[model samples]
Target: MQPDNSQPKTKPKIASSTTDPVDFDHAIGPDTSTPDGRREIRRATAASAMGNMTEWFDYGVYAVAVTYISFHFFPTEGGTLMALGTFALSFLVRPIGGLVWGPLGDKLGRKHVLALTIVMMSLSTFLIGVLPTFEQVGILAPVLLVLLRMVQGFSTGGEYGGAATFMAEYAPDKKRGFLGSFLEFGTLGGFALGTAVMLLLQVGLGDEAMMAWGWRVPFMLALPMGLIGWYLRNKLEDTPVFQELEERGEVQQHSSLASLIRGYWRPMLVMSGLVIALNVVNYTLLSYMPTYLEGQLELDPQASLMVILIGEVAMMAVIPFAGSLSDKVGRKPLWIGSLVGLFVLALPLFWLMGRSFPLAILGFAILGLLYIPQLATITATFPAMFPSHVRFAGFAVTYNVATAIFGGTAAIVNEGVIDASGFLLFPAVYMMAACLIGLLATRYMPETAGASLRGTAVPDAHDTGILADADA
Candidate 1:
């Protein structure tokens, strides 16, 4: 799973097409890139990781601390509804964020814009921590809260697409999956850090005290990220792949919507299924799991958090390994294997979470491992499915659109199903269906992990072999 020193280091040549340019040696850039463009990948991955971590960290903290904030911000009678509504509404804006951010990343450089976004997110988060309540200021309080969330939404929309595209461009021809997966690790790391901090506060200060003041701590913590994100991104250079597109005047400029319609639309459609399968399985198991276990399964909230915390720890270690292995063994096999395992395992393990603490922990650990497919490969592969001009637009819009539909609704839907069905098995059915759809998609689409980011989509067999050979 570690970078395979045993494999031949030859670079695979992509097919020639009007759209596809001839392979070029690494040209001069602020970052030192290797002959085949490996250094750019490393720098891109590092910078992108910082961006992704902060984006998810702020969002995760908001979700974890929402109940606490609702207690302070909304009317007592309607607080829960207002809280859930606020969270859902924030997600509703993500697609719009993707739309606005994508073409900009494609047009302007990713580094400058992403830095601006970090500053917006940090300020918004800090303001949330210090904001006044409706009890003191009336309905205006909730309105102001919603407004702040919109700004956060707009900022994150750009952060994700830009970061993902940035990493994809720099990834080495053979090692894209492993290297790009560091971005996923950053996401998981941020979420884990945020959730762990929330839970630590819950354990340290009980819910009563937490709702009173402790919840504000996590939101306020984001203020420091402004300095950190800006610092990390300061020395980074533009992605070489992107730089090439900029020089050639191939970067998309109209709108993310126009780019998606012109030539990049099909890849966006492909990613729709991809995101559905991914978000359904991931959110069902992660974001919804803690509440599901504590509420439905009648376990301790702290215990459920601890279980997921352990699972997240396992994920931190396995993601890079899985990405690296996909570089050698091929992405399709890993994708199919993980899905099949989850298909078989979902029902039984979810049931066990309702039965005992240890079983719940074990079940979640396996679920975390299953996510290595996404954590390691998607960043490298999905953007490679589009031309450099549309890669940002294609990858971000499709992902955010699908996520808007499925990911944001996960907690509400799963809780609703459990509320209605009285059976824990329904979520398992959802998982099975998602994994199946994902499995079928891989069989049809060729692997693109860590290959040239600007390759043509829908290639024939020989080109497919070229893509497979290019994967790291």
Candidate 2:
């Protein structure tokens, strides 16, 4: 059947609220005044940003600290390949962790999932700091290290989805995108902090001390931050959309794989695609760039991470503007624009940056700034796709699947390509490809920025039952 061109699309009758649906002036909580409205958005959004920064700190420390750990973990001079290889392999476990806990977030609550991940991450990180080295514990030491790394990867996989979902849900209808982007802000902020901490350690410690003890400090110190995040996540109220679903008996009682497949499968596919570019860029810029700078340019590891920190600071500033722009214009174009820009410039930007420190920082700042559009939009994008009942789970699983495939493998693929082909440009090409996929996907997905958080159950003009129910 050819798509209909004759019948004009009729929009639904929306209930009128005083505030503009596209711009959140005063739409959330009991606060209608500007001060109160901004306060609510800030307070709720802070949790996501806070949690994200802390967790990324954990992961970033791993990457930056790899230099310190190679000797201790592998101890054999000829086995650097084997050491980094094993460390990289732990990333594959991220998808499983995401797949396992993501659904629970959908069925249970974002806050619950967020809190759980904080605890798991904190415990694992602290234990990793204290784990016996291969020198003392024999072969089992590295094996245990891999196991703990898996736990950390798993926790990280859940962390973003829950935090993003929570922020999106709490954001007022007009400012959902702006609010949701804070999740990434938190994430990148954490990334910066981790790099900065490692930088500080390097400045103060000798090479021997760094390899011995300074490497452990970053992970061990996370205990207090994780506890603080857990408290904030637990104390926060659930999103208004999720609350409405619960009151209406709309929440799915079980998070069974079959149940999610039965109901939210379409969203699973759409969201996975919708959020992939950001996930790809997110990892490419945040995680892979570190090794790229340190390995390729032969820059000081400390200086390289510090340069990246400046880029992250730019990222933090750009996120809110992009998100707020989405509120004013819409989510789709902003997202597509970012992807398209990346497709066009990723190769040059990455290539130039890899050549010089000053140029590298400049390249990163530009890439990170343009990439902010995805960070701003996707936080609100996924939640808007599903009904409150299944929004949490649907968003979490799909987001994780995309991240696992594209995001988790970013560093691995970039490094592998660089290693195998002796071409340093693959990371840029890889980023471009992911963005192109996202550009196409964003074109067909429905617009939901101003749509009600509770889904409309009426089917589209076509007589598909599930689409009809989603509309209702």
Candidate 3:
């Protein structure tokens, strides 16, 4: 069923108190069936997407080029672990970034916070390109590198949540899933672009040059990409959802954290559980798979990157279709089915990937496809889990905390596990465990398909006149 767009006959009862039995029937709805709305959607998507692209590109280059980075920054002994450890260290501060930026986004507006984060993240990434190596600077090289990574982690905590919230608020209700997929598309596309560039540089410059100077090019490129994202975002108005709350003098009556803890804890926990599964699969495939293939499976480095590139492109192409499909069938069914499929296929797929290059590509492609349901629906589903007043904070804090724990550490944990036990299939087992936890949490979430973002969490509470209750 399509979402209701008609205005309510009367001003709807606002939820003034955390305990108030208020409805969100008329809280906020989609903008534009007109040319202007479509134009704004395009503009909003580009602005949000550009920064996200840069973020993932940095991640891709770092993950794909971990060996070179390790050799340059850290000492020869334990350097690979240190390099990957630095990679993981960046994630440790994500929750701090979330805490600092989330409420500010709620109070000051999403666009400005977005603008600030992009600049910070871009600068940090760009500077990494110029930092002196251990041979030149001794112990200071890795220290500076770790500091920059901390800044990158801090900025990104706010970036992902704000981008998702901004896009979801701008999107049409019935089409939210379809439109929101663009964010993740940018995510995959950015990673693919980064990987492609690294591959080209390696082929063109040879291993020595690539390790010495060529690897820096992708990090340097972040500056221009960030500038583009900033310009696009600066031109746009805040979302109508946020704008309305601002105009009504209710934008931030209390801190987003306070409001979230007082009233929105349930959705926050459920969303975090879902994030654990999403990020584990996401980080494993996009950021850690190349390492796995080369270090453990003994595939050629270039060949592993090629398989990842192919899988990323394949996944990027399918995200929108998955998002659109969820609009018709609902979020829970697709999520449930996808988790089940992953649980059943993960170990076998990991085994298949070890057999041959062609088999690895096919294995990664199938896993990427299975991941689409969650990725495509995230922006559409997670934002709706909280009210506009605390949506950014709720999503940011919970999502980042979960990612910090499960997603960021996935590579390190899998590597450690395999190193200790010599089990090549450890990542599959880890992912399977995450999938089980996710399925249990997903079972209790409201279906939320075609459900109004303005509606209250209570089932069948129709005061908003915008939604009707649906099953999970």
Candidate 4:
């Protein structure tokens, strides 16, 4: 059924303490309708996006440098699989991190939790650069890498949910889609920066040097990038919606997980379904593409990197426009279009990719652009699924759980299935399956574009007037 967007006659009643009532309007941050308010919103966007960029830079570097990682850390036989497995291993602990940090962000505030998570993520990423190789430490080398990856995963569990919530709450109701896209802009920026850095080093230092130590340089840069993100985040205040919750004593003081499962299970399940598609496509295109191109398709390492780099840049360029478009036309339509498009084209594009070098770039670029609608609207769509109180935990727990199951393991799953069946189109088939799941979820997803996120009530398209038509 299409969402009913008519506004209700009265505001929903929020549970609040009578003795300590706070003015809701006053609790919200600077007036976003004003120029000064808009400036502050932009700053908040940058701070949130920077932390995200810092986090993904690590993943990007790790993904592109998997060959070196396998060589240095694992045995000759099944080394690539081991590296991919380690990559998946980090995701195993993300749910635990979410369980711990998500509720804390609800109780403690988004900024505090985000600050701590970024530091942990960056430090662990930096430490990977300094870890001893298998030749140096025998069995302990891979062990250390695995441990740090877990730390990165644990920290990331909190980082993304908090950042998205932070960006969403700070943005004006009308412009949330446009502003939120910048956070993902930072996402592709990080991946592009990391890929570009790795490529440059591979070219300048030669393959021998890159294998020896050049890969470490990209990991090391994560520290300073993290520090800058920390600085930017520290300069800002918590989201206005969160502040309003705090002022009214609505912030969850105890375990939010139990409450989340009991009260908001429907949205949690829906979000999880959406995430399955989102991250499968996400990890496949951004994280696993280089490996698939190089290992499965028999493309050269440099050529694979070039393909990924070009595709990512193209996606980055289109992301903001897609995000802005979501505001006018609504998020569900863009998502539906994207899922359907990818489902239809995944096979053809993957086939085209095998034809030649230029075709590979063209195929990847087309797939990436098809993916932009979903990628661009992530921050705008997911956080609005729950109210301010459980938004962090709701998003963190479900997203991490689904991501751990399907996303983090995407590379290994694709590689294993193809290795077993000798089916070259397995990845495309896998992505098509995920897109089907996403389409089902998107059908039921509430349209929240231009909807106010100020209250504890779940934002719904039915509760507010339609901002625009499908053609708008």
> lDDT tens digits, residues 341-368, model 2?
8899998998888777789889999998
Tens-digit lDDT track of model 3 for 1-472: 3333464443233256334333444444334667876788889888888889988889998999888898899768768778888889889889989988998888898999999999999899999989999999899999999999999999999999999999888886667788888998989988999999998998899988987799899999988988888898899998877886676655655575666666777877888889888889888888889889999999998999999999999999899999988776778888998899999999999999999999999999999999899998998888877777677888889888999999998889888889889999999999999999899889777665554553223222133233442322
Specify the poorest-scoring 10-residue window by lDDT in model 1.
455-464
Off by over 4 Å in 3: 1-31, 256-259, 454-472
Q: Cα lDDT of model 2 overall?
A: 0.72
* Runs off by more than 4 Å, candidate 1: 1-20, 25-43, 74-82, 255-259, 454-472
* Colliding residue pairs in candidate 1: 41-170, 174-472, 176-450, 327-472
Clash totals, every prediction: 4, 12, 1, 2
Tell me the lDDT of candidate 4: 0.88
Native-to-model Cα distance after best TM-score fit, residue 6 in candidate 4, in Å:
8.7
User: Which parts of model 4 have CA positions greater than 4 angstroms off?
Assistant: 1-27, 466-472
177-269 per-residue lDDT for model 4 (tens digits) = 999999999999999989999999999999998999999999999999999999888998898889888877788788656767888788888
**Model 2: lDDT of residue 304:** 88
When summed lDDT is taken over every stretch of 10 residues in candidate 2, the lowest stretch is 458-467
